[model samples]
Target: MTTLGHKSSMDHHLTGMSDNTVERPGERAPLVLNMDKFSQVTATVCRVSEAERAPIAWYICFTLSLGLLSVLGVCIGYLFLTGVGVWGLNNPVMWAYDITNFVFWVGIGHAGTLISAILFLFRQKWRTGINRFAEAMTIFAVICAGTFPGIHVGRVWFAYWLFPIPNQMEMWPQFRSPLLWDVFAVSTYFTVSLLFWYTGMVPDLATLRDRAKGKLQQLGYGLFALGWRGSNRHWHRYERAYLILAALSTPLVLSVHSVVSFDFATSQLPGWHTTIFPPYFVAGAIFSGFAMVVTLAVPARELFGLKDLITLRHLDNMNKVILATGCMVGYAYSMEFFIAWYSGAMYEKFAFMNRAFGQYWWAYLIMVSCNVITPQLFWFKKLRTSIPIMFVLSIIVNVGMWFERFVIIVSSLANDFLPTSWDSFTPTWVDIGTMVGAFGLFFTLFLLFCRYLPMIAMAEVKAVMPQADPHGAGAGKHGHAHH
Candidate 1:
């Protein structure tokens, strides 16, 4: 009788209701909804990977992504054969689409680490739903970002020189260059993020291993599962490793993008040289990264039938972040002009003026409208909660961010100090194809990750669920009674 009463009280507390009671107006909604069992969570996430056939949408997306990947390959091959002259690299506009795309992709990679490491450290339970794929996105985005500098070096074979390894010729990388800083910063960020991502997935991989049917399936999943037996020791070590990796990754969330920003901030170019670039770049990176997350989350939830696991609450929270970061980006934008004018340097003032009303005024307009104006719509609760609205806004934010980099790079460089050397930049077919191909690479990898790996962190999600509580309901009885 005591056990029964205790179970009843626990159920009531977990559900926030009973037979005759109602949930209060201010009560927080449950993270997982429309599901009552841990098995259901397992089934929902695992089925996508386990199912023999994926949805038609997956095939359609895969086909398109593969085609684009081929385009990227062909473009890269052509560039290697024909030389960098194939790009629209003019006198002053030596840096254009390549750097723009590099920065854009690097920025895109930021949100995942922030969501996984920073939020995890803060004990944000809501991150459980989206962190898995976000980490995957981070890895893939870095892969895409790394491609640019590899090819941008022209002699792709000598790219190994970017590292500090000694050679027969005693050629060494210029350690002081921010460009070298990018090589180390980005590589370190990727290594830590990959470990953090794989560590979180171990238990889920073990779950998949147990549920796997065939011998081949068992072997494959088992290998990655690292013999995870869900024992107390296994879990204790996993938690420790995860916490340590999270700590290591937290500074990287700020440092990597800041290093990327240093590539420009360290330069003497009028618009490029700004102390604000570090924080500003970090904000824009997070801003664009969250937008990309939302961009992926919406379709993923709908297509994979993961609405219960990744609920509206998650989307709402992410949108709120987008809004907050969007504001930070906007503030950064205004400050650029303020500081330029405040400095009273003719060239600095001219750079700011030229960005708003110069040869590339159209790009500037697109950047402002997309980055500044579009995210403002999220200020309204109705719009923020609406799936369709947020998706469109997310994409728009990324487009604006791309243009933001374009305006920053092309505008400043195209019209440098010497009027005689000023040249209007134009992207050739190869330039457009290479950028598009990077997208293909990103999506192709993401689709494969979604198909093979658990998209949601099943272990973390379960940890957040009410039933996982040690003291709830059958706590005393379960402790006394053997399994």
Candidate 2:
């Protein structure tokens, strides 16, 4: 037993006991918590040895991802040389591959914000394990998504022309245009996401820096961490900043997609002009984004031996979210059909029909099965806990989400009010290559993150540890995953 007097150490307290206790003269009392391994960071901390991974697997991941990035480059170069003709967009379908890709990536980005910000605000202690990587994924996925619209414009050199800087050219990008709103929405989302991801990284970076040995390592971590120290005072302020930033990011999460919806909603196209676009788009975003996260996380968890940290419980939690959002999107589909018929608008009715049974009928069916029926497997706990099932479901969700975009873009334009101009849609190699490249781009960044960064938030995990708790609960401040 330790002394409980001034200038002496105190014994650990019982978990269920009241944190506060008043002692009469000379009475022995314990400090609030029993500091132990279980109490630390909820198993989120990477033991320094665990940080090392098989370098060859990492190399292969990087090489493939880089090759894809190069392919994306070649495709973009070809697009610049050959013009928009390469994408199979002609006649009434002025926007096809670019818009489809834009929506797809935006949807892929939603889960990161939900995992990092929304879950944090809810004080879901379970998020401590994978939130760091999820936030990182958010930043890179947005980068890939933001690039599509940027390069989709033919003149990649003057892509900045989307910016509304006052110039001698006497041309200001029209704020009234939905395209300009995309310019605003995407850029603002990217900027804010970058900031949010970086702020979350500061503490994690400091952990890495403390563990670093060399001079260059010291400087690298020092600069990136912005001179972070594990002072309680610093953490107190840093946490408040993080919470405020999360609050800001949550709204942008909604507004960015809503603005993207506005690009279609405000349009006059039969399929595009609908009030359901905003909420429908948001639900689809979360569904697709969460699926992508599982796709990426499955590999990382196994390859990195993070199964304990990224437990099956976490996957199950995310799967439930995916299932819920999938249903929401499916309901939106029914709502669209109902509204189309109820409104008695022939054009809208025809657009929904053409989506289901028109030239793109296969695309619509694929979307329906993947988004609506596929996630139903998640109702069984076994499917979610099974890695292979999770993997296949992830790919299915991504395919469906892509089809959702294709359906949105292709069906709307291919069979608009003018029957004379109606044309079917097909994606060219350039479209397919760029899509492949975006995956490459996402993985390349993620691989680098796994290599250098802690891949998990070490400090945040520590904060949830029983020792980190100012008030004790049980033997530790935090409970065990198994418990």
TM-score winner: 1
What is candidate 1's local distance difference test score?
0.90
Q: Candidate 1's residue-wise lDDT over 1-483, tens digit each?
A: 123334543443356321211224644356777555679899999999999999999999999999999999999999999989999998888899999999999999999999999999999988999999899999999999999999999888888999988889988888899999999999999888898899899999999999999898899999999999999987888799888888888998899999999999999999999999999999999999999999999999899999888887788889989999999999999999999999999999999999999999999999999988889998888898888999999999999999999999999999978789888998999999999999999999999999999999999998887666655523445553435
Error of 1 at 284 (Å): 0.3
Clashing pairs for predicted structure model 1, backbone only: none
Local accuracy of candidate 2 as per-residue lDDT tens digits, 323-433: 999999999999999999999999989999989999999999999999999999999877877889999999999999999999999888888987898888777898899
Model 2 alpha-carbon miss at residue 387, Å: 1.7
How many clashes (backbone atoms < 3 Å, residues ≥3 apart in a chain or on different chains) does model 1 have? 0
The C-alpha RMSD in Å for every predicted model, in order, reads 3.2, 7.4
TM-scores for all predictions: 0.95, 0.88
- Residue 456, model 2, lDDT: 73
